[model samples]
Target: MSFFTRKKQQNSSDASLVLASLGGDRDAFCIIVARYQSLLCSVAYSSVGDVKHSEDIAQETFVEAWKKLETLQDPEKLKSWLCGILRFKVSRYRRKAASQPIEGAEDITEGEDHEAGQIGLEESAIREQEQALLWQTLEQIPANYREPLVLFYREHHSVAHVASALDLSEEVVKQRLSRGRKLLEKAMVTFVEDTLAKSAPSLAFTTSVIAAINLASPPVQAATLGAGAAKAGSLLKWTGLVTLLAAFSGVISAFFGVRAGLAQSRTQRERRSVIVLTSLFFIFAIIFVAGMFGFKHLAAQHIVSPTLLAVISQLWVLGFVFSYLWLTMYLLQKTRNLRAQERIFNPDAFTHPADSPSAKQREFKSNASLFGVPLFHFRFGTPEKNDGPVVGWVAGGDRAYGLLFAWGGIAVAPISVGIVAVGGLSIGAVGIGVLGIGTVGIGFVGFGAAALGYKAYASMSAMGWESAFSGGFSIAKDAAIGSYAFAQQVNNEQAADIVQLALFGQGYLWLLGTIAALVIVPAAWHSREVRRRMKR
Candidate 1:
């Protein structure tokens, strides 16, 4: 059967069902309840103003209807009779409310003037900050007349229908809605005056939300972005930047053909590779350095948010330092090969330089000792005669005594320190030493990305002697926190702390990303190439 046809038949039989119920037919009484129960409940809600109470009223009205069925003069007016009973119940409820003593009535509007002033002060405090706050005004209607107002125009000024809906007299409904309109001017003026007294663009994050209900304008917005939009933008900017750094660094690592080389073993291609590698270093270095320096007109517009600045500031700076590390490693190879030409230097694995007129080589003889450590002293041999190693001194007296210490030098030895150095125990921009210290250190006691030390700190990844603080993948015996962290005692994170979650998630995500970039993909590619070569 069609739904509309069923509905039509039900409506047509309502009058017949009312008659049957009046004649004491139980099945007909059930039909009448089913036919009008929802309508009664809705009408009851408008009167009692409580959904649950209105439901109770509907049940009472139904019980009374069954009892008084014989008293209903027109069986067709059965729905109307039920509605009349609902009005009596609502009237009793309102009278009961009026007799009760109101409690804590003064607290709702206390200290209103103080809250008004706070809105402006908060905005001023957060102006220089990255917060972008905006306020919105709402329509003000009179409270005194709200109870009397019955959705008038929509109901077309029909007093009977309005009174029935509100369970009020037709006269009262007409009087209240009319008086409410008359006070509209006074209500609007008071609302506007209160708002004007308190409104200002100066709002803090908390006050901004409250002030947003009335008076709001954009805060001294950073990057022309609102709070939500800027957060999204900064998130994208950071993710893209870190990902690019990893990709470019991996590309440079691959292109340089990871191998150890001496001056004689170096081909012309290898020397040129130094130039190419240096250029690659500058490419990533410029991006990170620019962010630090605040290249406003460029892609480094990340300074708009201070929190992003602190996090990304570390990122780019580390990138710059890492680039220097690659350069240091490359130059260390070159320096070792060139230095061998000057003196008998021990190198287990060697990469000879390109074939130059170096069958005959001159060795600079100089050495110094510091802190019982020997230092090799020599000058850079010149761009034309760039064959001399970058090392300054060598401990040829006791070859066991190894130290490439100077103002700054790259040491291939176990212990070294230049202004920028690399060795087992070294200090420089990239500290690839056993116990090293630098801007972006990496070693047993290092302080940089993937840093491991007795006391180590890195933004992305850190493993310490006891406890480490990192963005992700951290391990410490005393305490640790990252995206994936393990610690023995005293963790600062709680189940509800969002900052901890973000840091931990970020660390693990980037670590997985870096591993994919440097190890997994390269290994897979190498494996595929090996298989292909064997097939050939």
Candidate 2:
């Protein structure tokens, strides 16, 4: 029968079984269990590598299936559905087991023997020697490929059915099956060669069994029948390697760049710069490491929640942009300050009334007026007149706030949603509660810091203005007005500087947060240790 027709018949049988079991027919349930018991056991065994545990997993599968029988959409796919549950159960068990103490010597050896026996078969010499040989060949392949092969051939499943059972794409199923066949064929050839060279006279019979089994086996030419099948394993391995290298490079570049930038900062700025840079560097490191470990693809495939990935990506982008903007603004301000200082020191080089001849003063004054400086304005008025400093300060403050919101939101939202999505509402609620508390704490801390900094700046500005006004000699009323205007301009410039400092400080924090969220958190603790040592 065609695969589809066979599947239809199986579905019909399964539907009857479900109906009977739901009607309180114990025998019908037992029949259904009996029909799939071995397959479920095998799947569990493959996943967990322990027969006893596999048995427990299989029982759980049946219990779950029985409890949820009403929800079964198609009877024919019942076996595949049960197997899927068993796989998940086994994976969970393995995860749990990994955290526990190791098994004792007796348990370990017994488990190994049980696994060997699970696949081992001793058939009657005359009845099915060839089939046994084929089974042996199947056993020799890796579990990754073997499970799909067994599902496709032994269970007589289609590619789509096998893919669903294994939670893989149909293309992946086909690829694995193809590679599995080649590996099996190579194994069979080796087996035949070994048997032929054996000193025992029964070697010829073994060869005959292998040849006969090859003939009886289903026609599935794994190597030649599928496109790109042979290279799939290689492709996956190389891609993983390349991704790991790229992630590592990005993390290193970010770390050193931040270090250099902070190292150049004034002593007063270093503490905040270091804290912010360290946080951001670690965040990106976490994300890069996670990507290296295939978490990116896992999230994409819906094996893990997608929110974590999105939040990390968005936070990193925002942090990087803010940092870049802050750096650019800082460089521009520094360059302008240097030029201003040079002009102040070399006053004769500047086109001021004291530097220029009386005849040229008219021309200079006209030019200054054209550039928005009033014709009678004093030289010091130029300092107070420039709006660039104020604008830069405002822009910096905006960027800082924008980054703070983006980073804080990214970290908070994913953690809240992911916990709930993965662990349900109660667990998720606790996560959200913690995050909400943290948000409040951060807000209070930021407000307090901003207030303290503003107070300090105001005190300094008051002192500086008083010093400038008291130290100056007397001048005419218009010039005095201009001097006060210059004082106001100086105050504005100082305010811009203060704002820039605040923004840069906050920008650094956001960058650090991004690194911590993206990179450091996800990196293996051992890898972090390695990185520290490498830096040293």
Candidate 3:
């Protein structure tokens, strides 16, 4: 059966329909919708200007009215009550649209004459384009002005009626209309030259409004996640899991368990029946599972399922990266801060290099700007007047690029871009640094959410990788990409984590851990070797 079909409903007056609807009559509710849909739509259209949006407001209004039908004080005031709800919705719409207008002033043509020689079919289209642009400009105006401006002209509403609907004084409504028109005049948009035409609503419009109302969402309070946030991210889980897993897999744990009476291997009937260590195995299984749960909780991918879970369980990557970032950023800031501490000033843009201290200015590039900020800068010099290779080049400002060898150089300023960038977002290769590609991507050895990396991308495991792939989630990792074709989501979501190490020197986000391990392990190993050499 169709949603429009009313099996037992018959023609009813507005009073009768409202009373029946209030008494929980479904058919009567549908009848009420049929009767007032056109009126409600016209009221909404007058406030909003756009027909499609007006219909939507009418639909939502009727849906809300149905939900709160029992609260209706008077059946006669049903239309008035709905109009009140609609005004509120229109206000919300205007506020959202005001921030980002249809198009900025620069996007449109300054002064184009569409009506000059055009006529018949061509003129109609041109006029429509002009009207649309004008309407969009109207939406850009302040809401205080837009409401009365739309209501008065679109609804053919008199000052008294528009005032009554908006709960405003007629004088205030008049002022709004006047101010709104003045804003439009200064907006550089061509008015359609229409004399405020008003038209009757169609039956199709009424039916559609009712249908939309029937399909609207029900009223309910939204839930929040206060508890989950409070309990998230504890490092104890990883350490506890490693400890528990080690105890179970070790040789010493099984030997301590008793074998029935003698605490030895079973013999005769007992030997024929069982190893009798099943209880010990079961205990191990439980401990292993409990430990695994905690370990997985710390991992990013062990979360993020098809459900509405977060992308990261804990901001471990962010926490780790920001630590490195704090150090790097500090170093950069320190270099900038100490530049002025010297008694002998460094040679600057205007100063001759030879006139300054013995520091070599082997090469130089500079550009000046209107403000104090330099537009471009490039310089290679020895730090602290040292003779070590003249390896520092600091180039940057309003627009700058710099490269320093040995000690390392930084390029900065607005819109900075290069191999190493600080101020602006860097887009070059090598670092594979942080997030990229909005949605789907593949990189060989790539670590983050997406992949294609020539180096074996390592981390927890990437969404996808081969032998060149490293991460917690990659399937058939380096063996082949086609191995887990159907299971891409699992493989991708499982993405690998970069451990801090490499056969050569380490790079990648995981290098921090790798660096610590390399240093500590080598020192321990060498200390033992040194002690052995002394003992011999």
Candidate 4:
């Protein structure tokens, strides 16, 4: 009889499959493998929250079950027995993974050859990221709710199948599903369901398990087929290695392209700064990648929640991309500044007619001046050569640069306030500097509705490389205190300490005060000088 015919005959009951497989029927075991691979993987995924590791645990569970088949007293309870084996394997795997460092766990190309051909490299990466996000969201849901949801979707979206697999009442499963769906949110519920359904183990997984068992025993009819399959598997391993190398080569090419661009910079200082920053960027990128691996290791070991790692990884990517683009823009801006300065230094080569309003309006100076820049200078019109550059002790209007204070559409100073502000203390719609407070703030220390920084406090989304405190979604590498948090140390009641350290730096408030006096004293003296001169 064909495999499907045999499967149909053996599918009547788990008891029959167990008895037949025990009586040396390989086809019966194959049927058993196909019957429960998805269910086992779903159970394992609820514990592990990783597709590859879950599948690995499931396969190992089946092998162990086959080896210890005689120990099972009740054939009717085969599903629960298999699940018991799976639980032990999951615990052992966690223990082993915990004992090993992340570097020691770099065995990437063992049995994953079967999966490597399913999707293109880029698509695979994108899908994995999406799945990671889904898993992270699921991590927020309680285990009881999460497990039923995962199982329900993986078990062909059948409540009856889930209830049977989990050994729960159908009504209980329905209630759990409803609660889980609510906790997951409506949009995520659909995505989680679809992802789980699509991620079920394929037929090749069943064949591989059967092939593995046949190889161990050296079966007469299956030996040749197993040998051929082994050979094919080895070839696929080489193919996977080549694909990995191709992806690595692309990264190398991009690195060289960056080097070439840095080499073409206009000035030696600009080139040196860009090169140094780019090197730092690469160094940080390496550290971030290593950190991600470590986070994954922690997740595998159950040391940290997978949700925290996922959030950190997502935030890290966003931070890295933004930093790279900002650096590139900074380089271009510096190049433009240098060219403009060149034109200013060689006015003869860039001369305009004496009667022209553009030439007449291009320069402005206040009578109350300090160090050749005015005490208060404002450029109050459209962006043109005639608008001139605003430079003063206190500058205001569009694109203002100030020695102490700047207020404009785009402002930069020791203290700045604008639509887009950059300063030691910045407050604006989008603020970026040492201390930023705005609608969207990014700095060493940031406070806003949406904040990203080393230390961030927000009413809404907040992500910090080191620490984050928020009422909404908060993610951090070290400490996060919020209603919804992802961190190694969450809700540890160290908010005051973190804030103090970020602001005063280990009780050096005196040093900070002295630094503030340096700016404040000078600004005060300059202001008095301007006022006295104005009165005269």
Best by lDDT: 4
TM-score of each: 0.29, 0.25, 0.27, 0.39
Tell me the spans in candidate 3 whose CA falls farther than 4 Å from its real position: 1-17, 23-49, 73-80, 87-131, 169-171, 186-201, 211-536
Best by TM-score: 4
lDDT of 1 by residue, 1-536 (tens): 12342243355444444432332233345545655554565455445443345555666666666665545555546667777886787777667656752522232123233434666646544431211111111113343244334234324446676566456788887777677666556535344333322321121322322222213221110121111111111222333344445345444433432321212233344456546654555565456534544522221132243333434544555566666766655655654455444333433222223222341122223445566433543321212234434343352110112444332334445654332445776543455677664435566655544456664455444556665544433456666533334455322222112112233333535643543343224323333332332221
Overall lDDT per candidate, in order of appearance: 0.42, 0.36, 0.38, 0.60
Where model 2 places Cα greater than 4 Å from the true spot, the runs are: 1-11, 50-52, 67-77, 104-106, 109-144, 152-175, 188-536
Candidate 3 whole-model C-alpha lDDT, 0 to 1: 0.38
TM-score for model 1?
Answer: 0.29
Tens digit per residue, CA lDDT, model 3, 1-536: 11222332345344434533432234456666766655566566556665556766777777887766545555556667777787788788767667656542232222223323345556655654755665677667786786676556545558786686567899998898888778886635234224234333456665665565446532111111122111001111221232333233222222221121121111233222223333433343344334333333333232433111112312333333343334334533433333323323432321543324342332233455434433333332212222222111334221234342111222332222222233322221112223221011123333322233332222222233333232122234333111111122211112111211122221322533332332233223323332332221
Span of 10 residues, lowest total lDDT, candidate 2: 444-453
- By TM-score: ranked, best first: 4, 1, 3, 2
Which scores greater on lDDT, model 3 or model 4?
Answer: 4
lDDT of 2 by residue, 158-199 (tens): 788667666799999999988977886764755533431221
How far residue 306's Cα lies from its native spot in candidate 3, in Å, is 53
